[model samples]
Target: MSKTQKPVDELSAEEAADELAALAAEIARHDRLYHGDDAPEISDADYDALRLRNAAIEVKFPELVREDSPSRVVGAAPSGTFGQVVHAKPMLSLDNVFSDEDVTDFVASVRRFLAFPADRELAFTAEPKIDGLSMSLRYEGGRLVTAATRGDGTTGENVTANIRTIDEIPQTLPADAPDIVEVRGEVYMRRDDFIALNERMAETGRTFANPRNFAAGSLRQKDPEMTRSRPLKFFAYAWGETSAPLAETQFEAVRRLGSWGFRVNDHMAICRSVEEMLARYRAIEAERASLPYDIDGVVYKVDRLDLQERLGFRSRSPRWATAHKFPAEKATTVLNAIEIQVGRTGALTPVARLEPVTVGGVVVTNATLHNEDYIKGIGQNGQPIREGRDIRVGDTVLVQRAGDVIPQILDIVPEKRPADAEPYVFPDKCPACGSHAVREEGEAVRRCTGGLICPAQAVERLRHFVSRNAFDIEGLGEKQIEFFFNNEDPSLRIRSPAEIFTLKARQADSLTKLENIDGFGATSVKKLFAAIDGRREVPVSRFLFALGIRHIGETNAKRIARHYLSFEALRRGASEAEIPQGKGDPGNSAWQELVGINGIGAIVAEAAVEFFAEAHNREALDALLKEVTPVDEEPVGDVSSPVAGKTVVFTGALERMSRDEAKAMAERLGAKVAGSVSKKTDLVVAGPGAGSKLKQATDLGIEVIDEDQWFERVSG
Candidate 1:
């Protein structure tokens, strides 16, 4: 169950910390799938909701903000397929505003930050927020030197060759342009072009999910010829790393880029007041469909360059600008049926099979039902949703493509429901393995108890083991894993992660060689073996995550791995740890140590202990361990630092930096920052309005210091 169901203010410090850690890991995974892989699982609305919730929690419990918070991250780390380019100026993202009130609050905050009088008119430049790949073109001495994609803000993938193929991008700027200017904009495909490209690719049994995906895929092509064939265009809206200022205002700067032969949006306007900005937003949103290319929203930026500089930036986005996203497009569709899909963790999720409908220009056939309660018209708080109208199989439902991505059922039309339609009876047994599917108290979904015996769970676990953040074996993709898992040949089939290591050996003794297979050539088989061999030695954190343990995501896995340092140590600790029966009950020394490791909560600790306690799990783990050696994490920061390996807690409002920033700084200085003060705490950083944590530190006789003193000691 998600911790976000409860109000942020109502959450305890421990609950807030756990939610923050989960959000960080979840957001990071989505970012990687969207930016790095060009495949996004959730809608932009869903993604935004997660970020908004994280922000809300952080606001309520400032000291509980984690080092890996989503606010501190921008885009995904660059895939190593292309040469990396570190930007001269970081390519930051823009914060989002969903409603008129949010926009008003943003403007009010900006005015407050600048100490500007309410009487004076503030100007903002509003433009269509194009949905495409962000690209940076660097020019030197009137010639385009390089082009790069926005890869994690700090560093980007060098796509100069593919970028040169786009006709809209200027090969050379005028002599009046700066000696070194990095023009930044979106590389997009027109709706007509996207449709035509899809039609062409359809004949070859391959098509892109959307125009944005097509544009991204086209731009990242290793072959320039392949990219040249695609109908891609560019629009200059911003600049990065300018040797000299382009203009005094944001609108003029974009206009200046247009003068240098770059295409600029014709709908760009300057709004003098909040009302005018809202009007502009409505006008743009109304004509969004008629636009040649796709745009998800309208971006509003501070008109004056001086004010923008004064406003500065947040951790990942600029403070002077925000994107007011368009509402989710809605459509009516027939609910054909509901199917249960068992995930890696064995949670049986109900998916709504809808009659095909178009929403936000994308074909929608499936929507998430969330769980049994959602279908039964129950909200997270046990309140009625859609006026307590439950959904039925033959009902006419209103479907919405939230944030122009994943479609979800909003409500059902009671009048249109078929007379024969019956209430969905959520299964009590696992559909795959016939094991009792149990819905534990406080959890929203029913989970299969079949565990390793369930084929669905086993396959999903195998997929997770070889996922990008896990072992990441090069030739072992999802399709290949599925193929090998169900292969008819005994020697070729791989039911577990340990079996993957035995494939080459098994194939060597088999009568039918792997190379003789339809899709496999001798060269391909050799490369696959080499790729599989490459992953024999993986980082311990990734190895633990690959195990697909509940509550143990990438962040928690790293925390556990770093604490244990080795797989044997972790296994021993988890095996010896005792699970507590109630709140505030310390189980054992191992359990206490696990729970006391800063961000590692009791839930995660219990999950680890439970997994280790299972004999089947331990046996499978031992078998896999024989085939792979998990490497320990190298020590980070200076080992000689005074706070190295010491647990420190911060209380109240920090003066110099945010709680996240402070925690990151402490980690860099080799200190482990804990959320609460305890006997294990080595030091405490106390700010104004210091609460129970401060008193606890004093009671424990732990050293306490102010923000300035912290800087002083860390600086040395």
Candidate 2:
């Protein structure tokens, strides 16, 4: 490890292979801790040093590139809780370069790929690489239908409901576009908001390790409102599956995306050459400290769309793009104070509000203090003080913020600590709820035991229930929900999920008071009522899931709805045997078992059982039912058409029904409509946007039906 070796005469083949293997394993372990657990054991400086060393090794010995090498990966595997979603196109990692020679080599490679002259000018787009999850937002006929997390390049979890809660994300794009398009972006927490959020989380006695972890956890939450309240921002960087052409160059594409209502990263450049690109990268690195949020690096893309297409992709990354990361940001500040904050869902977090100091050109006043174990350097052991320990008041702290975004304390200088300073202790009671906060067995988090009765818990829970991803009652958006609850008389507090139903009848004399609520307005109030009215009938799946039962999720709700078509049927059919039991109280095991059916796991079953068994929950359910009817699932044979229960596909120039119309028809007839063909695809619908799916269906010898054939089959 002490030997200094050059690229060409570095080491023997065996030595290189051994070192490469060692580096890959080390990086993967750190990646898991950082990305997966939010408990990184290394500083950004140290992590980059490791990454840079590994990349250099790979550059020297390309043969050492294993399939699982971190050098070739963009992100780690998706966290366990969220459902999986696949990308239409793989989300690939970008190549990296730190020096002028590397930039020149990249240009040379691009020129070779495009058969262009060295002197010929080429366009390029450069933007900050925000530190957050990569996601895809898909629109059908200009309306956002789904948003998905970029899971393993091939598949990802669907987060349509949570994405809808992001006010920055457009619900509808302009009508001039294609029938379908996928917009790609990063979801991040604003530095200021991240501080506020952690403060709230701490008060609730649930400590989040960092903003990125909190952001990811919030976005992947089964409940959409949980994501909504977290102040997440999105920056569009790429596009996928456009019906029409986007732009001539990558720069234009970003511009067009911004024009179409997507928030593009404000810091970007259109470089004409490698020199200009390098200069742009340097400029960004210099100002990184001034940015409001965290960015890991700067990204550079080959400008022309045609050139990009020609460069295509190599295994996991595109040859047309590379990330030019700055030599990470580091700073020092005095730890002013550590405080706890509660979240809308009652998660408590620890916040470190530091004495204002400039870091990487940005003013740094706050950093994440993490949890009690984290503060004590117990969670990650003796890893760097930056990745562990909670810096306390009067301690001299080293802070690091990459790209001026995510500010974190690197270490504590013991010499600066007051002699009387002691290890901080987390409170046993929720500051907001005054409830005994308990850290359940096997869980690191300490949550308020007040449940929904606690003031903070009550407000947060109600907010969660009315969120866009849950009941999605139109008039009851986040602002309205806040307005309705916050303005309620203290004596007549909106204490339960059932209480939301009584809002219309409650006394509110003026719109002024209502409008004065944190996020409400006149038109918004009207929209809220209309949305609430529109939700008089909701799908049984959504209705049940909206109850915010601890473990039951969207998928579980669907299974429960399919198993029992009506509320009465579910209530009567669920038995003790169906409940999934584990250690602890096991809640309502019998009721859990009844809804627990095949797909419902032990966790979900227990939550369902517990919810149904609770008398208060049952009364809330009754109240909800009075206002909204839950639609029963369509019976197996309800579609009386000839094509009923038959899988159908439409393909090649539709003469009759629009593809969406055709799919809807097939669904109505109880047939599953598929996007692509496999051994399982029954009928292939391939009218335009019909790319590889049509060919696959034909190759598989599956029935290939044109638009007319699709209409004829559905009509039959």
Candidate 3:
């Protein structure tokens, strides 16, 4: 065979493999600094060049790719606070090319390959790449169906229940629409919302490092209510599978999406040629910092749908799309303190609390300290850490964020620290609980032995139980619930979350007396009671989740409930189990058996076993059961019926049907109407202004049904 050009043979197989791993590690380090950390050593153009070079090298040596490579990964792992979801389609990273030369080369490559005439201009659509979580939304028969993260391409975690809470995502579609439509977009926390969220976190002694992380963490929450509480907005940028084409060109498709009430990216430009595309890219680069939200880059896509298909894709990214990233933001800030935080799993993270500093217009206050090893390398002694010395307390440090989300601490400044400063001291006991804390083998955290009694654990766990994912008690926010529970010690101890349910019966007079307290009016008190009353009958999945078993998230809870069928059965089964398993239930086999069921992991199973073993937890559960009931499994809806057995999510504004009315109608028709869409979604009823759920539906290839058609079919 004649070779057009010999591939670079500078490195042999072993050498190339080693270098590839090193490159991936280096890039991932930089990615943490850029995307997660918000600090970059390189300029926008330089970073783009580096990424491009990496991509080129990887492209040439495809076998060197690692499963965890930054180039192959789309978003960071989901935060521990929310339930995780895998996406149906892998959220692929975009390829970026900088400078006019790069754009011209790209155009040349497309033209030469497609055999287009030089005079024939390639109409390219340009839009701002919103620096937020990329999501897919599905709509069937004009009603919203499901929303999901762009996971590993074939499957993703179901986030449909949570996505429904975003008001910006329309719950229904216009009077007329396609049978199936999927819309793809970004879910972003606005600048103001991000600031407010951080402020709230600060007041509660919690922290939100940046807006992008906050947005991603919020959007992925198991509780739709929590996602809705954050000021999350969606801007439709692309489409997934469609029964019929919405428009011919990318510009027209975006316009139609807007017309159909989708929040299309407002900052978009039409470029007629590669030169124009370059100009637009540069213009966006210049104006990146000035935009209301963060944007790491500008994106260019093939205008024609057929052309995009023809161009096809590589193993990781699409051939049709590319992102032109701006420079990474970099700045210096004083390392005020290094504080350790315990996550739900008891991972102790060292955070470099910094003096407020701005990079790329956004102010940053904290950066990741990594771990004890990183801390020691940075120097623990009073001596100031130079770049060579790593970092030390009271030293000035460099910071960066990529796409303006994560915050990373760079080198330390020795010149700024006082001569008498001492090395930072690691704490031996839990800061919140003051319990005898010990760092377990193979773990980074020094955990308190307080268990359920720890104030922080008790408060946080209580919050989680009533969170949007659990009992979903409305009117009881994090602060309000904490205020009530935290104060119980002086008067009485609230040992369990089920105590909240029994309060109405045991403390009806006290509850009335609460209205007379400062800042507590009768209206507010009534609202709280009403909210509590509304949630007396929660779904089995939610009830299981509300127990606050470690690692037993919404997905696991659902699976466990489905397997056992009833709480009595589950409790009996767990009691009969001989060994400890999932979630570590302190070496209890019964706990292991619970998690061994489908969708239940060892982490969750152990937690359930541990919780049931605790006398306090069992007592609390009994109290809760007295006040509330779990949602029972409904009989299967008739498959012959149009809406039967299908999970339907609603989005956007609906003129003909109120959302509640539609949900009621769906129930009346024996349809299993759901708040969010997942892999199980049968149809999505979309409306004008339908948001990410529309994209999720189309991507899954589930039917998208519109309201008018829905009315017609169901009514008939």
For residue 299, give model 3's deviation from the true position in Å: 2.8
Per-residue alpha-carbon lDDT of candidate 2 for residues 625-708, written as tens digits (9 for 90 to 100) = 777778886543336776664545455555454344454456557665443344645667667567666777778798775666
Clashes of 1: 0
Q: Which number leads on lDDT?
A: 1
Give me the candidate number with maximum TM-score.
Answer: 1
Q: Report the Cα lDDT for candidate 2.
A: 0.69
For each candidate, the alpha-carbon lDDT, in order, equals: 0.85, 0.69, 0.67
Q: Which residue window of length 10 is worst by lDDT in model 1?
A: 198-207
What alpha-carbon RMSD in Å does predicted model 2 have with respect to the real structure?
A: 10.8
Q: Supply candidate 3's per-residue lDDT for 501.
A: 69
Candidate 1, 1-716: lDDT as tens digits: 25538887788899889889988999999999889887666567778899999999999988888888889988999998877899999999999999999999989999999999999888999999999999999999989988888999999988887787789999999989999999999999987888766533432223465688888988876545457778899999999998899999999999999999999999999998899999999999888777878888999999999999999999999999999998768899999999988877788878899999988666899986778888999866697878888999999999975434445788899999899999999999999899999988887768899999999999989988998778998888878888898998988999999999989999999998889888888999999999899999998899998998987866678778876778888888898988887887757767766776657788888899999999899888889988999998765557689788787788888977656457667777777766666667889999999988889789889999999999998888
On a 0 to 100 scale, what is the lDDT of residue 16 in model 3? Answer: 59
